[model samples]
Target: MGLSHRSAQSHDHWFVTERDELHRSDAIELNGRSALNAAGIDIDDVVYLDLYSCFPSAVQVAVNALGLPLLDPDRPLTVTGGLTFGGGPGNNYGTHALATMTETLRKDPGAVGMVTSNGMFLTKHAVALYSTTPPRDEFRVTSPQLAVNARPRRVPTEHYSGTVQLETFTVRHDQQGLPERAIIVGRTGDGARTWSRSSDQGLMAALETEDLLGHSMRMADGHVEEISAVSREGLF
Candidate 1:
C-alpha cells in the first residue's frame, strides 16, 4: 500500500492532497488496518503496542484510535535505542530494530519486545513484535477508525495552467558570503500547475540577500539577473 506524511500546515497539506490529487495516506491507513484484522489480535493478546514514534502526531492518532492511554509512569517509555541514539539508519535502518529484538527475546524467552518504524518524515509507519516463546497475548488494535472518519476536506483544485516551463533549478551557492538556501528558475506557467521561471533582479536580489520562507518568486532575464516579484503567501 502507498503511504504519505503531510506537513502540519493547512496550505502544504492542500498542495499534496488537493493540488497533487494524491491519496497515499488513505491507502496506507487501510493497509495497516487490514494487517491487524487478519492477525485476529484481540485486546487480551496485545501485551503492548508501540506506534511509530518519530513525531508526536503519529503516536497521538494511533492511541486515540486504539483507545490506549499515553505513557504509563511505571513502565519505561522506550524499549529500543531511539533514532538519536543510533538505533538504526535511515528509512531502511528499521531493519536494525529486528536484529536488536531477536537477541532480546532470546534471553527473555517469554518476554516481549516491540519496535516501531517511521518512514518518509512520518509519512509511513510500521510496528513489529518479538517473543522467544509463542505469543499468548492477543492483538487488539482496531482498524484506523480515526482516519476513515476524518477525511481530507481541502486540496488545491487548480494547477498552474499558466505557460511555465522548468529550465533549471539551482541550489543555494556556498561561495565566500553566498546565501544559505536553494533556488529554482524556469518559465512561468499560465497559472495552471505549480511552475517556475528565470529569477528577475527583484527575486534574485532577495534570494541573494534576504531571508524568506514559503513564498513565491520570479526572476527576470536581462544582462544581469533581477528578481521580478515575491509572495509571502507561504508557498515553498
Candidate 2:
C-alpha cells in the first residue's frame, strides 16, 4: 500500500518515543495499516508476513500494534523464521525479508505478502506488501510523523530517586547462561520515564521468571538500588 518513516528519534533515548496504549510504537501500526489500505487491501487479504525481528521484543511489539494474533497456527509471523533464526546480514533484514517474500509469492502464484523493516532500536520503520501480480499504482514513500509527534511522550529522566512502576525490562545472561544484568524502564508517579541497569544476581533472576510490568520499585540516579525487597516490598 505505502512505505513510510517515523522521523528523527529522541536525543535522550534510542528507542521510539511515540508509543500507543500498549507501549508499542505507533509508527509500526500506522505504516503497516497505511500500506495495506493504500494497496486496497487489509489484514485479511495478506497471507504472508515478515515482522522485523532483530530481537523477539521487536516482533512482539509489531504483532501487538498490528493486532496480529499471538498464537495463530495458520499465519506464521515470518517467512524466514525472522532474523534471530533466519540469519541477519547485519542491517539488511528488510532485503532478506523481501527476497524471501518474493520466493514465497512465486510458489503461491498470487498470494500477497507483507514485510516490515526497522532501524536503530525500532525508531525507524517501513512496511511493504508484495505479490506475484503486477502493481496497479506507482510506488512511493509515506510519512505519519505529524500524527506520531502529536501523541503523548514520556520524557526521559536522568536523575530520579523514588518509587516507580516497571514499564518494560530485559535481562541478559552471561556466557555460562546465568543471569548477569538487566536493563529496565519504569515510570514515576508523575509518568516521567527513567532507565536503569542492574547486575544484581537476585534481581536478574527474579526478572527472568516473573511478569514485572507494573511492578513497583525504587531507583536512584539511573540505578536500581536493590531488589532484595522486591518480592516482599517491591523495590529493585
Candidate 3:
C-alpha cells in the first residue's frame, strides 16, 4: 500500500507534521488495525508482513501496536529483508514491498499478506492487506486519523533550555557505521516536548551501551549533558 503527503504543508522535508499530531507508533497501529478489520481478517491470519523500516523504532512501534511478537520465526517482519538491506529507494520503498509481498503470496495461494508504507518520518502511514482468497466482503479503506485526532496533543518547545526527561531517541551513525550523534525527544517539567541533538562522542557511546528510553538530562548552550537514567526508586 502507498501513502501520499497528507497536505501541502507536510509536503516539506521536515521530520515533524501538523496534521493529527499522533505518535508514529499510534498512527501506524491505527492504520494497520483498521486495514486488517476492513479486509475481514485478524492479525494472526496474516502470514506475511512488510513493515515500513525507515528506522528500528518505526518497525518496533508497529509491532507493538499490532501486538505481534518481536521475533517470530514463522512470520518474520520483512519479506525484502528491510529498508537498508532491501534498498530504501526513497518514497518508493513501499512499492517494492508490495511487489515482494505479491510474489510471495502468489507462491502460497490463500495466504494473506500485509504491507505497510510510511511517508516523511512516519508522519503518514498506510497499510494494505492482500490474499489469493477473496474476502468475505468487498475491500474498503478506513481512516484511523479520525480517532487519533481526538487525543490530546503535547505542545513542543522551540527554544527549550534546562533539565528534561527523555521520551524517545535515536542515534545517528557515520558512513563507517560508528555512532556519531544522537537526536533526542524529551519532555520538560511542564510537559512540553523538545528535540535536541548531541555530538559528544563519550555520551553517545554511553547511550549505545544502555537502554535509556526514560533517561533524564540537561541542555545548555546547545549541548546535551548530565546524562543519567531514571532509577526505579524514582530517583535520577
Candidate 4:
C-alpha cells in the first residue's frame, strides 16, 4: 500500500481553478497517477478503482487525472457506488471504499486497486494503492508540502471594474430544494479570478437551466451587474 497526502497551500478552492479545472485538475496538489507512480505501480496494472465521488465533479476530476472514461462498463470508477448511491460518510467514505477494495482484490488474486479521496474544495488530497500481490518495494508515505507550495498561486484581485467572464458557479438550495443563492467565480479580462455571490431569484432560476459561463458580468467598486441581463446584483 502507498499513501500520499497533499495540499495546494491556499484555503480558497478556486484560487487556481479555471472553466475546465474541475476536469483537468492540473492545479490539484497530487493525483492518483502521481501517487501510483511514487509507489512503483503502473496505472495500467490497477484493476479496481474507488475515486471519491461526493459530487460528479469530484469523480470527473479523478477521471481526467487518471485518464479514464466517465462511464465504462468494464471499468466502473468505483467498487462501491460511492457517496452518490450510498450515503456520504464524510471522510469516513474512504473506509468503505477500502473495505470494498479488499473484497474485490480477494476475489481475484494479483488484482490491484486504487482509492482517491479529497475534501474542502480540493485543497486536500489523498491517494492510496493496494495489490493482492506484494509490492516490489515498500510503500512510501509522503506529505510534500514544500514541493506543492513551490507552485505559483494566483492571488484574488481585491477590486475590479470591468467586464468579467462568468467561469463557473453553483446554486445553493434550501431545505425545500429551492435555490436560494448562488456562488460564483468569474475571471477578469486579463484572466484573474474573483469570487462573488447572488441571491436574485430570477437569476438563480436561470442558472439552473442556462449555460452561463462566458456570460458578461460587469463589476465596479464592489457592485456587480448580471449575465445576459438576467441578473442584476452580486456580492463579493
Candidate 5:
C-alpha cells in the first residue's frame, strides 16, 4: 500500500486519506515501524527501501528504525543514488522515489519495497510500502503521532551558558565546496537542548576530523567556546 500526507481540503482523493491514515513523526524509527505495521508487514519482508536522503541523519534514523546495521554492504540505501547524486527536486523528490520503487518492484515480482519522504527539516515523514502482489486484506494506514507524542521531548534553552554534550551536527558548504558554517545541536548538563552555529574556520577544520557526537563543549554568550572529546573511561 502507498501513503501520502493528507491535505486540508476535504477532497476525496485516493492518495489523501483520513487524518488517521495521515501519520507524522519526528522520530524516523517510529515513523518507519508505524508505516510497516499499517501495511501489515515486517522489516524482514521489505526487500527495498528508499530512505529520505535530504541529509545523512535522515538516512541514519531510517536505518535505525529498520534495525539495520549502519554499514550493511548488501542492502543499497537508495534506488536512485541519493538527493545529491539523484537531484533533489524540492518537495517533489519523493514522487521520483515512489516511481523508482514502483519500477523496481515490477521487475522483482512478489518483493516489497518502501519509500520514505521528509518535509521541512526532518519534522515531517511519510512512508509508503509497495509490492507486486496484492495484500490478502484491504490496505490500511495508521497515524503514529500518538506513539511519537508519548516519547519524551527535549526542552531547548535559548540562552544556555554552560557545558554541553554534542548530540548531532552538520556542516554546510558553499558552491565552491568549502566549509561555510556548522550547525550544532547539543544538550546542556541539565538535559536541556540548545542549537548554535559556529563559523570559526579553525574549529570547522577540526570538526571534520573528529567524531563530535557526545563530545563535551562549553557555551557562553550564545556561542560555542570550547570542545573536547569524551574519553571511553569518562563515559563509563
Candidate 6:
C-alpha cells in the first residue's frame, strides 16, 4: 500500500478526493479496509490494525477517513509507544515493530496484527500482516518489472520564494568529522528543495554549546550565513 501525509496543499485536495472515492469513506478504518478489499481480502481475517500514527494529523485522518468509531473502549489503538515518547528512529524503527509483533503473535498464535511503516516524512506507506499460522495468504511481490518511474514533483524554482515545511534535515561534518555546516530539506509552495549554510565558526559554536537537531533556520538569499566567528574551526 502507500503511507502518505498531507505535506503539500495541492496534494491534500487530491488525496482526500481520491481517497474517499477509492475507500468509500473518509476514514482510516475504511482506508485500511478498502486496501484489503482491493487485494480481495476480508477484515475479519485481520485480528488487529495499528494506525500508523506519527503526528496528530495521521491519527485524525485515519479516524475521519475510515468511518471508524471514535471511542472504542474495547479496541484501544497504538502499539509502539507514541512517537513523542518513543523516538521515531528513521527506517529501522518499524523493524522493531515487526519483531515486537512477532513476539506478540508467538504468544498468541492465532492473533493477526497489521504493521504499517511510514517513511520519508510520512510520504510513503507499507503494510504487512503477522500471524503464527501464515503461508496461506497469496502474495504479489513488488518487482522491478512494475517499472515505477518517480520524479520529484514540479516545484517553483525561481529566486528563493514561498513557504515550505522542513521535513528532516541534517548538518554535514568536515574532514575532522565535526559539524561544519547544516543542509536542510525544505519544501516551498513549489516543492522540496535543499539548502545549506557553511561556516566552521557558527557550526563550532552550535556544536560546542547547543545540539543542532530540530533547530530551524530560514533561507535568506542562498547560504545560511554565520554571524560571529571565533577561530577558523572554533566558534565564539
Quote the positional error of residue 134 for candidate 5 in Å: 1.4
Q: Give TM per candidate.
A: 0.42, 0.79, 0.74, 0.79, 0.74, 0.43
Per-residue lDDT of 152 in model 1:
48
Error of 4 at 178 (Å): 3.9
lDDT of 4 by residue, 1-236 (tens): 32222212212234445323433454333445456667666667777888888888878876876677788888788998887775555568878887878888888877777777777776567667776677666656555445455554544675677778776788999999989888877777665777777888887887789777767887775446667654423412
Question: Mind giving the per-residue lDDT tens digits that candidate 5 earns over 1-236?
Answer: 33232111111112211111112234456666776666666778778878879878778766775686666667688888887787766677777888888788878888888777766545666667788787666665556666665555556577679888776677899999999999877776766678889999877887887777778888996689988866422321
Candidate 5 vs. true structure, TM-score: 0.74
Model 1: ten consecutive residues of lowest lDDT: 1-10
Candidate 4 C-alpha error for residue 32, in Å: 2.3
Scored by lDDT, model 2 comes in at: 0.72
**Model 5 residue 106 CA deviation in Å:** 2.1
Task: For model 4, give the 10-residue run with minimal summed lDDT.
Answer: 3-12
Question: On residues 14-118, what C-alpha lDDT tens digit does candidate 3 reach at each position?
Answer: 335232232445666677667766665678988888888988888887798778898999999999999888885657787788788878888888888887777
Once model 5 is optimally superposed onto the true structure by TM-score, how far is the C-alpha of residue 29 displaced, in angstroms? 1.8
Which sections of candidate 2 miss by over 4 Å?
Answer: 1-23, 174-178, 220-236
Question: Whose lDDT is greatest here?
Answer: 2
Q: Which stretches of candidate 1 lie over 4 Å from their true place?
A: 1-32, 48-50, 74-77, 111-114, 134-153, 157-236
In the range 77-163, model 1's lDDT, one tens digit per residue, is 344544445355566545555565565556655554444555543344454444565534544333443553356433222223322
Which is better, 4 or 6, measured by lDDT? Answer: 4
Clashes of each: 40, 2, 0, 0, 0, 13
**What residue pairs are clashing in model 4?**
none
Give the per-residue lDDT digits (tens) of candidate 2, residues 1-236: 22221111121123443242334777777777667767777788889889888878888988987789877889999999889778877787777887887888888876888888877767777777787776566655566566666666776787789888777788888799887889888777877778788988778877888766677788887787754334433323
Pairs of residues at least 3 apart in sequence or in different chains that clash in candidate 2: 1-39, 2-35
